[model samples]
Target chain A: MGLRVLAVDDEADFIETLVKRFTYRRIPVTAAANGPEALARLDREDFDVVILDMRMPGMDGLTVLQEIKKRHPLVEVIILTGHASVEAGMQGMSLGAYDYVLKPVDFGELLEKANKAYERKKLNESRDHS
Target chain B: MIQDEFGRLRLKLIAITLAFSFVPLLSLGLGLYAKFYDTYTDKIYGNLRNLVDNKKVTIDMFLSERVAQLSNLALTESYQDLAGDAYLERIFGVLQLHSKSFLDLQVIDQNGLCVSYVGPYQLKGIDYSHEDWFRTVMAKGIHVSDVFMGFRKYPHFNIAISRREGEKTWVLRAAIDSDIFDTLVRTVQLGKSGDAFLLNAQHVLQTKPRFGHDMFDTVPFPDIPRFSGTRVDEITVNGQRSLYAMTWLNLKDWLLVIKDDPAEEFLPLYRARWLLILLLSGGALLIVGGAIFIANGTVRQLIQSDREKATLDASLTQSSKMAALGKLAAGVAHEVNNPLAIIMEKAGWMRDLLTEEDIKASPNFQEFEDAVTKIEFHVRRAKDVTHRLLGFARRMEPTQENLDVNLLLEQTRSFLENEANFRGITFVRNYQSDLPHIESDASQLQQVFLNILDNAIDAIDKNGTITITTHTVPESGEVDIAIADTGKGIPKETLEKIFDPFFTTKKVGEGTGLGLTISYSIIGKLGGRIKVQSDEGQGTTFHISLPIAV
Candidate 1:
């Protein structure tokens, strides 16, 4: 199967655009409006990589990353930002986010981060199962 | 504060003027006193000597005439006729008629018996034998005696001539009144307080003073040479200062003393001295006062201009620094504007492609649309920033005209008002209604306010405050506007260089460092000054002063 993924942000348009693009590229995708929707989606599915916006209305990207790490220890997260709080995105990676991408991004560059995050998640899952 | 400066100037003026003028003032006082005193003393001496010399000649003539008269009588009269009372009375009466100074006449035998007396006193046979007159005439052929109080009990001197008859000696005697001699000497005197008196060889007063004392009484005679001429000596008599003009009369063997109080004698001279001192003192006061007044006025102007120049130097430094900053900002903003425009157009093109039919029908069309939208949005945002940079780079020469600074400030305030309100910031305005209009470029002045007020909003947190005030400076006749903000202030290290180009406290991409730089050049071109005052935590105040007319 194509890499399983969840894209999280408060910009519904940005998430909608991301889900459509990922589906066309043969990557299976899901979307969430905020941190709660993101965590709920994580609880039901085994996503390989989680795409997250660093700034949101409530439960910022870093805090949501902590919750994701506790529940799904094997899943990889990639941070997206407008550079408003690049420091927060950096902190999120140490908390187990796979990598980060700047907003208004080059499409090719973002696709590469997602693919790298998926490999790490799969590799961690195999080790845990073995 | 002004008092201290004026006081120093006053003292220096006084000291310098006094130094140059006091010596002459003092010399004039001494010279005037000396000149007048010498003149008065010389005049008194001249009068004294003239009186003494004139009186001496008269007295000498009187003595010689008397001696010649006696010698003639002795030669012409026989002893028989001179001894006869009738003949002797006739001759003596004739002599008395010529001068009333003669007192008595007598004829005495050389045996010391009074043979005849022809006078008021009864001396028909009074003992001439024991008297000095008889003994003096017997020893010398003729003699004039010293004054004595004889049997008559009055002061008189005798003139006598002795005649020889075979073996008998006959003496003819005459008494002269001392009053006539006193009258001759007493006529010589100075104006009140000055008197000429005669002192004899024995230091006895021969002629009494016009006021008091007997003829024979002693007088205080200074120890001068016997035949001294008119000489003036300063002496103290009865604890009073006097000018003593003295001369010796050789004919009468007496001293002529003219004693007078110098103050009385030189009263006019003393009065002159007092007047001169008063006049000089008045002149000195006038000169010193004028010097002080001139010094105070001149020094005050110098000090005032000195302070003004210091302020001007500081303003010049600020202007040059701002000029440097403006040039830098213009260079930077110009370099960034073209690339920013290209990026904006490219992002818009990306958005257009996402709306194409083929792409719209595709499953991934929505993702492409979102991506392009984000790109275009950010690009537009960056363009707004580049436009501000372009504004800085395009700093133009001021097109000056009359402007209401208050209105310009209000329009700039409106631009940031919404953001301020959303952040819960308050606006405090104190507008002076009578503020005069200033000549300035309105658009440029408005841009300056936009730069400063925008900075205020970014610097402050929620619930902050900004105060705007405008007034006319009375002394300078200039318009002043003060804009203050409650915010975390600039640091001490950055406050001086705040107007310098490319100096900013904001993050790199968030701030282009050209806002204040452009504003500075605009104000400089309009002939105005911009200054800032701030403390680390107390926020900042920007003061702008503009010329009312130009």
Candidate 2:
């Protein structure tokens, strides 16, 4: 019924702020500092949407996105990048990411995209059940 | 420095050319001239020797004939017949009728008493018993005397012969005219300043020399080697170099000498030599001139090509520098964006906290809200810079799409149409109707066109035209777009750096200077070229050529 989110980034302050903002909106959110930790978190708990930073210290966002798509086929991924690379965005989209967002994005816009991604996950899960 | 290099190159070329051409020319010319000189000298000597030999034979024959005539007269005439002066006079008259060289004739008895005399002066009883001619004839029976003035008061020579008659001996002597004889010996037709004469054993002129010597005048003669036939020699006479041929006459102890100034004798050879020298020198001059001319032309071309290469190298270096800086800017922007994002998020979270009622009632809430707002605003500005840096880096591959350049240009022009009108600038579009579509990124090409059009609009002070023309090159399968502006054109120094990132001629804060750089990169990625031509006051034109899609 509510949006459950995972905010993954190597930048602790950025990730902490993102988590606090999500918490302020009353969304259930978790945090991971790296791609491996994000994948570990995804494996333990169910998340509606994953806001994954494209560039991370270990196991970049695209790899995590692939692993998530392979394991949890119903989970939506939104790629966040500081660098605006259309090619990476295209690759992330091809890898079944729900959306790609550049850094310094407004929190409201990020929330809107995450909500849309969660809706898509619900739609995907409903279609699977049917 | 470049001029000095090229000058050295030109000189080296000229030197090599002259060495190759002039050396052979001089050697060949000198070789031919030496060979010709040798042959000509041999010919001249041979000719002079032949001439002298012929003249010697002639003089010898004349003397022998005179001796033979006198001996005939002595042998045929009896003592009684020649004893009278009248009979000897008649015989001398007949001898003169045959050859007028005889000046006088006389009949002398064994005592050397002159018995009869005929012609010339009065010498009817001149005693000649002790004279050289008389005594020599008494012993030798025939004698020819050297030129002497015996009772004749002038230069003369006598030939005498003895006749034996019944235990008595008589001598007949005759004087030969020296003037007539000199004329006979001097009949050589050598060149001007040539002299022919007869020199006796005493080095006295027996015949008058054609130049200054008189008959019997003592003359200095060169010591000639004894030879049987005619000999030719080079000698200096009167301080002038001359070639002479000498031969001994058969009948007399006289040397036949034919002397000539070699400068006159070998005039033709000298002339030919001069002509050869002239030709060789003229040819050398021509070769030198041609070598210099060709060297200059080749060096000019080399200098021109080197200048073009230097320009190309500089531009390539600039391009690589821009590319490296782009990468560096992208990395820096990307790095800064993380912190910026954290700031933006933290400020936004604070703003979110301010929305709660408990924090909104605090006394510092407005200040905190204002401070957070300022932080967000500055973050936005930082984000704008990072975005521009990422754009400049151009790490993303362009999305390929079918693009109609004319339509794209029209759309791009529309973006600046309002600004152009406000600035009193008119857009003149000259689109080729049948232009082919090209394979390129539509958005990227639009960006390039918009940038150029925007620049064109900004360039104008007021009241100017921006002309955009497009045409397809059938051969290159490319479409050429030319954008020209009648504005205060870019200065030459600024035009070359226009495509360099952050190099701007605009005043501070007026431009980011990345429009042309981004445009250049975009066009380069699309397999196109951008070129600019500008006249400082006249205008500027930007030409962009894009490859057509297959």
Candidate 3:
């Protein structure tokens, strides 16, 4: 199966841009514009990698990221933010976020962080199954 | 230069008024001398003319009256008795009674022999035929002699009368002293160093003090013709040029001339005129001073206003420059953040795909994992840097919350400890016991600690030690955090500028120089203060003070 990715953002333009970039990279991608939408998507479909915006309208990205970690511990989550605070980065990472990226994001660097996070998650999952 | 416009103008006015006050005094002095001297000379000339005319008329009337009286006496019935040898005393008394002005008298025959002589002569029966007046009287029966040398060499003018005595003519002569003429000439008062003289139609000095010696002397003729009207003439007399006024004494057939050394006679007038000129000059100086004061005041006001305007303009420009920089930074941050997010997302998917069984069994899976790990680590670091960039650009308002600053310091220390350990330096923490919580943006406080750590790391060599200390004061109600590094410290000159943006000790590309500046701004926004102490070769320490939350 193709690599699974979940992208969450409060900005539609940002989500659309990410979807385009992911499509170009031939990565399987799903997107949500807010925290509730992101949670609904997470409940219906299983993703190998989840990217969440740290600042969201309702049930902020950090909360959704925590829920993802709790429900699908095998899935890796990456947080996005237009205003990337160090405290939020630390908090996200402590809550099992794969990594955090600031907005107007560099896809190449984000891809690398996401891939490493996904590999770590896969390893942990396989390790549990074995 | 900083004075107001009116104040400077006043200064210039004072300077100009003092300068031009004396010009009119000089002109007035010269003008007074010119006018007074001319008038003085003219007055003296008029008086001299009157004296000469008066003397001539008196002398003429005296001689004519005496001749008439004596002729009448000779015509009297006792005339023969008086002519022949009657009483000499009685004759003299009668003649003296008839003519009081005659000083001496003589009677001579037509044959030029003196028959009877009056009192002073004492010459009885003396011959007088060769005398000029005698000859003239005998020939014409009446004669008047010009002034001549007489008794005691005194200047005298005489009138002679002759009458027929049957076959011979009897002549009578009277002599008058020129002293009376001298006295009359003296009465014609001249100005200082001015005098009057009588000049005949031929322009000779007569009836002057030296008239006896200079009776026939020629007058010192003027350079220009003497004005016939009541006007003055400037002339040269006795080798000196003087202002002179001349008038003809018609009765005396002489000219009255008055000469004044104009320079002396007008001296007082000149002095008074000079005083007036001085006053006028003072007025001119006042005008100039007023002008200068006004000019200075205007120029000063303009310059001061210009200086103030320039200062205001410079301040506005500085603020605008800062504003422009902030906007540029924000725009740059917004553009950069989106791309970083995509990179982090795609990298995770790749890492997951590579770890699948099929990919892992492939010979290149191990290579892929290593490449992925390297990319991931660096990508994570780049994301951190970008996050800091955005934080600096957005200028986000601080959401201060009550937090334990010691805990935050411990967390930051834990983060940097591993890195310091790799560099052979040990990190030490000095947390104050019973530290209080302060209101602050926790993450920004972390960034401030991190920036301080970064600067300390750059300053130190291997084996350098960094110590972090935290303290709270109950009395001051503030928290203090001090980070000290036993490393090659910053130079003293650059210590103050350490927190200025783009000022750095590191070489190009190694440090952005924005770290300390951003940290300073963050601390400032939190209502805290940061201070540094350092010695060039010893160590450096940064102290941060924060007020306790109310």
Candidate 4:
């Protein structure tokens, strides 16, 4: 696979735009709006990395990241927040997120962070194989 | 319930105004009495002197014309050379008619023999050389005798004249009755109980007063030197005080004396004056009473008005406090929500991972534990903040309970120490070890300490020291806790209203200003007191004293 990524957002337009950007870049994108939906999807699917928004309508992005880490321990989560509050960012990192980013997302930064997350997943996979 | 400083001052003003109006009334009463007495005394003395002078002038006019007519009749050649009984009779008749005040008229020859006599009992040839009037008339040709009992058994005075013409001498005499002086005495009318009398040159009473006996004998004569003018004197007459006024009848040499009983003469005026005084006194009393009544009424009204204003102000303050509490609640809710979301997220993550038996056996439990610990920290932080917020927001009602005052203080200080450290403050605790337990609500006392601590921390910029000391005052049955800070002090203008709700120096979103208001209310409900001492550029100190737990 070129790349396996999960993009999470509460806003439909932002998620759609993110998914299209990933698709054009020849990367596979999996998406969920909140924590429960993300956790439900994680049970049936395997992805290289998970992207989640910090603020959401219900079962916020941090909860989704937590659920993703618990279910798919090998997968990496990149946090996306609309307002870059220092305390919120700190909270996401404390939750074992790979990295945090602000929206409207910078595609180059997101691509780099996602690439880094995918490499980390590959390293964990290869280590397990050994 | 609202009788405060302003009401007490208004009551004092009413009392002062009531006292102030009494002085003028007393003065007015005294003034009226003085005026009335003065006016009456002046009138009585004025009229007495006028009548005496008029009588003297009438006597002088009669004496001068009679002398001139006698000389003209005696000096005529036909009348002087033929001096017969007929001639003499005509001359005597003219003299008698001219001097009606006289009692007898007589004529004597140059040899001092009675030439002619007229009137009731007269001798035609009686020898008159032994008489003083006869001898004086022969020598000076005109004579007047002192008052004496003369012919016709009358007390009289004589006017006599001698004439010489063609070697023949003629003497003419006219005796005036002493009772003629009574005319002057009788005419004087003193009001009500006053008397006027006539006295001779010898100071003998000539006429009796209308009231009784002659005052000349019964009354003390003033010991003034005999001077020829009007005089006023106060004398005691018949055991009563009297005003004696005298005027000399210059031509007749008589003393006109007026003895007036002052009380009777001025009785009407005095009584009127007394009535005026009484009326004035009454009016003054009424005015003073009215003023006192009005002032008292006004003060009562003012106190009522002030109480009403106080009631309105208290209600307004209470509502404003409630509004502030609402805002505090909303703000606290928002602050707490952030931490709650984080804790929920991390716990959810842990919950999902802990379900696998193999994962629990793995060393990853350490990683799970670390996450769980962080989640627990946030949850605890949220709970603490919410608990403090709720305690602060709770309305205070009067409730009594026994409490360990020093322990409560120490616990509060420990609770705030982390916050103080976060603000770079050094909080020192100096609690008395032997303090007695105080009665108060633990929540309310804690809120009071928190509010003071918050203010102390806020006052400091950085590196400030906050010192709290607690002690049990055994003698006063109170526990005093003093919280002091070495920070930028409150300004003088803002310090006065620091306890008032919504009055804050902190900028928007920094302070709600209800901290001290709530603290003050809580302490008041517990029968405790809170006081603040602040100086600009120095620091602020709050002293709280709570009644002993009972």
Candidate 5:
């Protein structure tokens, strides 16, 4: 239970690579190749943080983030976007996302931001439980 | 020195006008002179012919009347009676009473001897046989002899009448003095330097000529006409140009020649020619001078307009090139940005992963790190270059609003005032007070001001000054900003390219060169214009104009 996370993106290889890097960093990671798949997986699991890509084929990251926030209010999301999509990425952050970073993702910085998001989510959960 | 376009135009105009106006007028003057002189000379010749005809009639009448008186005497007197001197003396007395033209009257018998003589010489019994006059009088009824020295040894002309009295012929001959004919012919009026003289068939002058020709001298002619009416010809006499009119007398083998100097005769024509020449020359001067003046004014205007158009064309070409380049740069920068960012992060990730203790201890780990570092460095450089390109080609819509242009300039100037102080440069701001506010984007105008101010500082390099001035037009609702610099100015070759993207005088990595390009496009979007003036080794000035209330 070091860090529970779900990574959503349209690129299969990028998700796979993130999964491998997160596993080596001693964090528990799950991946979905699209926004709908990530939402369906989020319904079945209890992840503390979600890494959302703003661009996807079936469902965009912002759409997926909104669904996640409604069903699992305690979960925190971090946005991944390209330089051109920075404005939309900021919009996502205002919609209760933890933060945003530009691609190609630096896994180390992504891990740091993901861990912070997990801690914030756990802190809110603990408060609710107490 | 050679003439310029305008100078050549003026010269050609004057030349053409003078040719068109002067040539025909001068020729008409000359033509009129020739025609008038010809008509005048013809009229003068006609008048002289009438005068000579009247004089010939008088001379012929005088000779015939004397011959008639002698003929009456021969008929009245008998041959036997006329042999005596007394009856002849009575007839001579009657002839003298009528006209004193006869010098002597003589009576010759059939033997060709003067039987009676009533004159100054005593020749009462002179032998007349084998004399030519006695034979000419014996054959013809009457004979008028040429002037000769008679028995009196005086030059005289004689008219002889031969009569038959029952086959016995007697001749009555009267000798006339020649002095009476000279006075009649000399009385004809001619012009100054005009001479009227008589000539025989041999071209001898019978009467005294007032010119250089002496009496009895042979005068030359191209071809002597025979009994023709008065005809005039131009001939040179004594090396002077003269008109000669000749007429033949019917009564004798004589010609009347009149010599008139045309120059003297047509003095009024000479006077008219000089007046015409003077007037033509004056008109030519006045017209040519006016044409040249008009041409100079028109050509000056044309040259001025041509120069302005050329300057405008050059600037237009430069602006179009800049606009085209800006569009291309924007597209390229946008398309390449995503890929460059990807490469940068990937390389940065690789560098981050090599931090394990055992891998760091490897001999080639430093080389691996160096390669990754170089990749990241180059990627960052590429990012900067693309960012500048994107900035130059920015097509983002500007937010327009009412902004104080003076305040905007002050805020931009403050940004560079510290840098100016550090570089020992003086910044002079000449802002107009109470300038009319403009409807424009504040951020964009600030950016343009900052861009121009920063460039001015960089141009000065060290120890220089820049002056900024602003003015607002009340009528046109426009604002003008002039930024002058006392720095090493841009060359004329580079001035046209200064507003284009990536054209800079700064060293590598010092400037992106998109400052002015972005400022230009931004001003364009705001419906404004920028112009630059530069002198090498002196300084540069940039003028910007904007609508105050757009």
Candidate 6:
């Protein structure tokens, strides 16, 4: 099946654009305004990949990443942030993020990172089934 | 203002040194000189008193002996015998045999008639009762007269004695030779201008002086106490300062005076005083000179340290400014990036839409695509600026990695090789073959090296050489890299601010001006130093020294 993606950010317009870009690519996608909404959506639906913004109004990306990893170890996350802090990037990676990307990144690069994250999730799922 | 401060400090130091050194020196010198003067004056006066006392005794004895001889003659001889000229002559000869002081002898009756005379003159029958000695002897029994011109027309003084026999008086008189008496009084050994003489009660000279006046001439003497013993006084005669000692003779109203110039007598003391003055002045000059030298040296050190402190303060201010600006730039870039991301995403979405059939079919499709392309291009440029701002703000501890400085420099220079080649700039690498590795972040060091290389290439502009040299400083445990360029060098006025953030010589949009600022900060983080030296017309050289990994 094609990749099912969940994008979470406080910026509504940025989320909307990400959703449109995923839709135009013929991939199924979902959007959340913040960490709580994104976590609630993850509980209701199975997503292959999650694109998370590190800075948010409530429940920042690292906390959300930890909760998601504990609840659903099979799913993979891609951290996206406007603040280019290497320390935060390293923290996110050690917290089981698949990759960290700075904002204003090309859509093609983001799509590729999401596809790779989805592939890793599928591989993890298959291993669990076996 | 700082120069004035230092000058004042130096002057104060010199003043304190002089006061501390000279006050004691001058007071001691003056006190010693005064003591020496008093002691010397007392000693000179003491010597003069002793000399005058000795001479007075000799003169008194000589006069008494002459009177006793005359008195013996009047008492022992008969009047008939003394009146015989031949017998008186025989008595004079016997007196002369014992002493040469007597000049002549004569016999006179109580009426002042000269009955007998012997030697040096013919006054055998002169009128009687007219001579002062004859009249004085008749009443007093014995008389001594002062020096006078007698019938012989010569200066002489007589001693007379009278004897009464059966209501008749016979007088015996002897004339004392003035030359022999004068010689006895004037014999003294004093330095160069010393004189000795006898002065009678009337201030008349009884004898000739060594320097001035004749016998019986009036003389000026300083007022002194009329005591029997010797007294010393200082007097100025003929504008010459002299020390004179006087004593009254026991035989007569004569004053024995001995005088000498004190200038000659106190020559050694005066010389010592001059030597003391010379030493004081010489020592004062030495102290002043030494004080000035020491003050100058101390002030120079103070000035140098102050200058160093000022330079350090300025650099600290510049560093803090750079840090604050970096934070602001990072904050601004973070805030601006969100909007930049939205714009970029929207433009990408539009470009994606332009690929659809309906949008592609529109007549304005190319313009829409061109506009979207421009939006994406500018957005990318904005993203780049934001990324650099974040990098500048990221003052994280550098990761330590063993790095060969020469290899790192070569790699950095390679990035600008194409550009430098395009501008006809030549790269000359002088790498030490055995340069040691340093402990620093490789990528950060590369960034600093790249920045310097880029600046060097830019400075060279076109058709010039950029020389890169690397050497190890074994003593400092550091490695030095020198990048020199043969381009038009940085102007002196602009060189000082070259490392300041946003300070650039390039035109707008060509340079962000953060290259040197970032390089400086990076090198500092890596525990290295960066310095630049430039001559406006000659060229520029940037020297970077990095600590070698232990």
Off by over 4 Å in 2: B1-4, B53-121, B126-174, B179-195, B198-255, B259-308, B311-315, B395-550
lDDT of 1 by residue, B45-136 (tens): 67656666677677667766776777677778877787788988899889888888788887788788888878888889777788765787
| Model 2 interface CAPRI class | high
Which candidate gets the maximum DockQ versus the true structure?
A: 2
Tens digits of per-residue lDDT, candidate 5, B1-550, equal 1136567777888788778877887788778877987887677777766777777677767777877788888898787777778987887888888888788889888898889999888888888879887898899878876555656676567889999989788899988986676677667777777777777778766666777776667777555759566677788754677887777765566776777778877788788878877887887778878788877888778766764464455446545765787778867775576566456656655665788788899999999999998987787678777767755554232557788888888888888889899999987889999888889988678878888888888888898989989998667678999989888899989998787655678998998666777777778878999999999889999999999866
Worst 10 residues of 3 chain B by lDDT: B17-26
Predicted structure 4: lDDT: 0.70
Model 3 Cα lDDT, one tens digit per residue, B278-314: 8666766666766676667677677657644654454
Question: Could you tell me how far off, in angstroms, the CA of residue B247 lies in candidate 5 after the best superposition?
Answer: 1.1
DockQ of each: 0.02, 0.83, 0.24, 0.03, 0.17, 0.75
The residue-level lDDT of candidate 1 at B82 comes to 72
lDDT minimum window of 10 residues, candidate 2 chain B? B310-319
Best by TM-score: 6
Where does model 6 exceed 4 Å of error? A24-28, A57-59, A85-87, B1-8, B53-102, B105-119, B124-174, B179-195, B199-257, B261-264, B274-297, B300-304, B307-315, B355-357, B395-550
Distance (Å) between predicted and true CA of B150, model 3? 4.6
User: Against the hidden reference, what TM-scores do the models get?
Assistant: 0.50, 0.69, 0.50, 0.47, 0.60, 0.70
Candidates 2 and 5: which is better by DockQ?
A: 2
Error of 3 at B410 (Å): 22
Clashing pairs in 1: A17-B367, B325-B501
Task: Please write out the lDDT profile of model 4 over residues B1-550, one tens digit for every residue.
Answer: 2346656765566667655665665566667666755665666666555655665465555555555555565565243432466765666666566666655556667776766666678567788778766776788877656556555666666677677766867776666775665665566666677777666666656555577664344334554455776776677765778788777654445566777777776678877877886787777678767766776688778766754564456546765766687567746654564445444444544544565688889888878867776775666566556645544444333345677877877788888788888878997889888787776788668878988987888888678899989887778888899999998898888887787655678898988766777678768877889999998888999999988864
Docking class of 3: acceptable
Question: lDDT, candidate 4, residue B406?
Answer: 75
Better of 1 and 2 by TM-score: 2
**lDDT of residue B330 for candidate 6:** 84
Full ranking by DockQ: 2, 6, 3, 5, 4, 1
Which lDDT value does model 6 have at B191?
76
